[model samples]
Target: AFKLNYSFEGISRTKPEQNLSGSSKKLTKDVLLQKTHEERRKRQEQRLKLQSAELLQSHIRSYIVRKHKKDQERQLFDEIETTAGIQVILSKLLFFYYPKEDRERLLRIAERLLNIQADVIQQINADKSFAWLIKRFLLLCLKNTKDNQDSMVLMKCLYVFTVDAHTFSYLVSKDYYGHLKRLLESSNNYLQETIVLIQKPFKFIHESDYLSNLVLSEFCTNFLIPSLTHNVKHILVPYIRNQRKEFPFEKLIRYLNTGFHFGKSHSLLYCTLELEPDDYEPNSDSIQVLSKLSANLYELKPTCDLTVEDSDDEEEEDPVSTEKRLLLSEYLKILNRSDKVRKWINFFLKHNHDESVLMAFTNLCHNLLLVYKDSMRKYLLLYKFGLSSTYLKRLWAYLNKNNTGQFETKISSFIAWREYHTTLSVFCDMFTFYTETLTDSETSDTSHTFTQNDLLSMSKLLKNVARGLIEVAFPMCRSSSIPSTPEVQHLYRACLNCVRMLYTLDLRKKFCPSGFWTSDKMHIPPDLARKDYLSKKISSFYGARNEEDEHLPPLSTIEQRSLAILEELPFLVNFNTRFLLLRDLCRNSLGEDDYQRLHHDLMHENVVAIRRTHIYEDAFDKISQKS
Candidate 1:
């Protein structure tokens, strides 16, 4: 019984130990679970904080962008307000000062106001008082202004105001139409200014209201067209001739065509040209009319002179003089047409009296020759009418007489010099045409061919022209001489170009004879020839002589004269042309040493940088190699 009791005690003690170990393990597992929950809560808080920070940054960025845009808009509004305020103040001051004859202040104000015309025009439309002040001031200035300067200022102000549609409408409503019309009529003395004023309103035509269109039509019929008709020669002709930027011919035609009354009859008045009739052909009747007009223009004296009473009776009989005017206008129009000009020129060339008439004809032909160029070539060729030589002879004779002081007025000298220049230019054109025709004949089947007689005549004419030009015009081409007047300078340059062209043509050997370069009347001095021979021998010894020197003849007058002209008047020919001339002379008249010396001098003397490679040089080299 005692043994059984001890075993039960041992079993009970072991059971208690096992229960304590289980309790310890359960306590450790509970602590691990608490630690894991704490870690998960910390991670959630971190993630929420990161999202909040990004949201805050994006909101702040958007707020900044909105603020920047608002600030820029506000700044722009303030600038615009300030500009508008400045324009108003300037306009007010301009109005206040203009009536007091403050010309200087007015000009300063007008110029400043003109620069901001956009704002000023806007103000003129929005503010009735401002518009009234500007309109009244402009009218007063236009009405009372006697000074050209004041008129120009007023014109600028009016031009600016008229270009804006609203301001133009406002001005028209306030009796400005009559004042503007009167302003145009009164300002006829200032043709260009009147034109400027007249053209501005036309710019608004497409976008203009009906009243504005009516006003523009009135301005055109009552003022613009009439003034243009009366002064077409004085104003429109010069404008067209000069190619002025102020008013172009095409724009004027378009403006005139906008008028309801503008027809083919009025077309002649504006452009001094007529619509080419669809059925109109170049017939003998038209030629006869042109020939009659030419006879009248070239007549030294009128066929009959009418007394005052007779003239009145004739005027009463003719009433409008429409036929005479139409005939004269047609004559003037034909002078500009290349196709008709040939016939006109032929008629003019047939008659030869009166220096003034000849001068006019020469000028006309020169312009035609210049403008028509190769188109008029066949009519003026050497073998054809020989008109170029005829014109040149007449001009030279007139010039010779003028040189003797027979006609020494400033106007006479002016016309004579111009005639001479034009004659030379005409000759150059003809010669170029001739050479081109010759080249074309060789390459293609051309109808016109030059004969030996034509060549001989051309060469003789060239020699005479060259000699005369060198003696008369080239003396002024010297660099050391005092600078000549523009007229003289123009004449000199024309002469130089003509001579150079002639020399170039002469080199072909078809136009000029072999002996043309040599003159029997001119002989070189012994000393100069000997010096030249010795220098050439030395050059040959020093390996400076080229194979081209073996068969070269002695220098002649023509060669000497050409060389002297080129050497003495270097300023006349540009470097490239001079270089080519020298090269040609080297191959023909000059020795190799002379060419090298001149070439070296040319290279050194020129101020502009010379390109080492040239198209001309390449072409010349190719031609030389091919030959």
Candidate 2:
């Protein structure tokens, strides 16, 4: 039924109904109330629909924007990775473009991109076209054509490049060394520092390749050694020790070299080098360089042997122990070979050009002569035919000739051409652990091998040096060319005593009925084995007792060479004369901290020596002086 009802609105609602105005009005109201609820529901639905439509529109817009942004980044990465390489990307960054915000962003991205293909690196190096591109990029990266200024591009490139070895190998293969060398001469400290870090991998690259070998040889000969002759201090001591961490490894390598140490330690004092390189030019500014490194050169004190008091007697000190002897022996073990001896002599001769350096050599010589107290003379006799006392005397005179700027030698220097040529001709053979130590059964088959012949030759050489030093020091029988005081005579005699005592052990075989010569190897002369030197004097020593004093056997030049080689034998396996410089250096320069550490190591080295050869008695006092 339809009903109509009165409302606030002028119209009443009716739906197919007939009713009276008064009574029907009540009935209509009930009908209208039921319909009213349906109307309210329709209105609420409309409002909710409008709200949902607004929300859907907003989300769709946001999602489309995000997709576009990601697509742009992906496309940017693809374009850069495909059309061009990272180097191109880096090229866009010129030194002048110092956009702080953008620079930070690029730096972060480059840092994060650590891994790169080695094949790409190889290809880039193989392609010479890349060279032009690289040159242009670097030149552009520089801020200006003049005035020292930092290059962010240089810093960034190296920082990125040195991530690994292949990266460095690639850069080096491209012949970056030439440019790098040029850069090293620059006044800019940062450039030098950055280059140093980059060069670290070069150490590995130089290990096996022939080209690297050639490079190193040339570098040492032309650049390094020449630089040293003139400016050894510049090469050795950092211009600023206070800020040594600032200098590169390359500079340190110069100072770390052998020649530098020889001069700094002993050249100022009176001693001369036996060796001089083929081309040596001392820098005119050497004095200036020395001043820069060591302001108080005179203040530098000499090393003094440390004395530890014995517990048994308050005044007396314990003598060097067997363990100490062993350690010293082991230290010398490295020096036992012919190659090492040759190298030692070569190095000794070259550095011995200066007085201070010569003194260092003497210290080493003393160590060599003293190590095998009893066997030195036998070894000396083994090769005395080739080695000469005159040569040693000449060496000593050259060393002692130079005073502290007060006096210098007037005599012309002599370079042994034969010795020099012989040295230059053969490559130094690498030593073996067993061959050097006399423990390894497998010996290196090379030009230089430690054998009976070597023992004979080197023994002779060492003896010449020892006897020569004594003669020069005392001139008891020989006329004194050098100053000889009573004290000097005593020292010289003591040194002679050391040699004589050791000879007593081997000589006892003749004086004693029992044959003291243990191995027949020691008895053979070099002239018989290898014909190293023609020695006639040894025949008399080999002759009867009456023949020994009556006609003194003068070692021929060749025989003297043999003796010189032999004298250095005891020092072969246990200690090196070279180490004496290092030792004496410690004596003077090493503070308590270094002294304790080095002293401990030395003690350990000595202990090792004693284990190999025990009771190495000072035979000169007991045997040589007796007669």
Candidate 3:
């Protein structure tokens, strides 16, 4: 504790002077005078040393006091529960609950204990010992709902590992999907965080590993589509759109539970429709990323013909019977927010003429026309000749004539193609909803009469959406030997519904309120156009040569299925939405405006509306309040 600048030699030399009193010093003065004169320099040095020693004593006391206080505080903290020796703590917390933040403190104090080198994180994912810890943490996160006390800490550890691409890709490449699936049981608060963390690596992953992608894709399909969370649809759509099928999907129907609300799933389809070029590029191993991307898209947004009519049990049961539905719906929301929908729609027009694919085209057009019919003339500009020509009756007839009807039957059976039929049903319902809502809203406020512009806008929007949908679905009606049970029914109803809402046959009355098209009969063209598009898509699916090159086709069965599935995306997406939209409309007790309000209410009730993906929150009621 001492702070003396003087050495021990200086202290010893000056010690002799300390015992002397003033009188004793005076007696020695005569004797010391002669000695002092002889050694004046040495006496001066010793005097200075004495003064410095006195100063050192004060500093020594201050140092001792500070050290004592620190030691006492340390002792008290040690006695407290958390700091109960590292050995006991490590043994207790190593499993079930690792305080990642506290572990960080250990590193801060001494880096060598864990022996974690800077390169350790990257290697840990591949290293057997460290990899086990990562897996253990992953499993722990999935043990309970997102709000579990230990869940957040586990997520933090995962986050640290993800900081490096090497570690992250390695972890993801392994079966992290098992843990991801477990998150479905977690509360909404934790679900959001868990999904966000998991989705990070997926943004860059090509899904080269079949087992890995299949497990992950299935997990996502189940969790994303039925989830009530709006964000989920947006998240999963990119994986589904503009691609063929590479992922296993024999259980797709089972996976997409009846609880799925398709109207809200549009964002997913849109996202699937848009393709990312980087995803299409080959990986370092020269594996084609496009095939995987395409396959996932097909599974996500199928245009092929297929349907799963609700069995007695499914029809009788409530969709909200379990938590799985909510999770799937949430995933769908994430997919929808992306551009996957349009990508699949465009792909169908180019590849197949299946009715389901046709329906998807109609559905996509319906969405666009409803939202942007003001630019119909401009839409016509974007509409390619290839798409239009495929729909043209003469062109459709020419294509079908070449087919012997065998391909037609089998092609028609494809689920993606069949989904187009469902799409028409969905739009019919949406149009119905829109009309009812507009009518009620217009009339509800009785004091305010329906304005001329409001009526025209409503009429125009409805008619345009119907016409756009018909342009894609009507051709199938013309081509059908036996008209579709619901596809044609919905298609006809949709067109008729528009007329009913508009209170006019001249469809231009909706767009041009002046009735200019009435005299010219311009509305016929849109109706005829719908019939042409439907016929062409149907003929294409049945008749088009699926082989881009018979000699060098898809490298594997997966690639072929993916390509085939993608060919049917437009229809699958459209039909699925239609089925959901119809079911919802039929089930809804409310009228149009009330129905809209109810839809709004349901979405607003979702807890993840504002929070991060994996942020687990209070139960349903508390989440609803926050939303």
RMSD values, in order shown: 28.0, 31.7, 33.5
Ranking by lDDT: 1, 3, 2
Q: What's the true lDDT of residue 249 in model 3? A: 29
lDDT by residue (449-522, candidate 1, tens digit) is 33455445544554454444444432322432323443344344444454554455444434566556344233
Question: Which digits, one per residue and each the tens of the lDDT, describe model 3 over residues 100-119?
Answer: 43444322222321244345
Among these predicted structures, which one has the highest TM-score?
A: 3
Q: What lDDT does candidate 2 reach at residue 4?
A: 96
Candidate 2 lDDT over 1-627, as tens digits, reads 989986695667666666655453345777888789889989989989998998898889877886576456545654674456556554443222334434443443344333453543454567655444444433332212122443444455454334333444445555444444445454355544544533444455444454344333333333343322222224222322223333223323333332343333222211111112213232212222332222222222212333544467665333434334433443344334344355445554455455544444433333233333232332232122113332243342442232122211111111222222111111010011112222222222111333333323323432343444422432223232444422233233343333343334234222222222221132223332222122222221121123333344444433432333234233221234324433554465557788799879877884543554436544333433234
Q: Scored by Cα lDDT, where does model 2 land?
A: 0.36
Quantify all predictions' global Cα lDDT against the true fold.
Answer: 0.47, 0.36, 0.40
Off by over 4 Å in 2: 1-127, 133-153, 159-196, 199-211, 214-471, 474-495, 502-627
Which candidate wins on lDDT? 1
Work out candidate 1's RMSD over C-alphas. Answer: 28.0
**What is the RMSD of candidate 2?**
31.7
**Shift of residue 377 alpha carbon in model 2, Å:** 20
Error of 3 at 3 (Å): 99
Candidate 1: deviation at residue 321, Å?
38
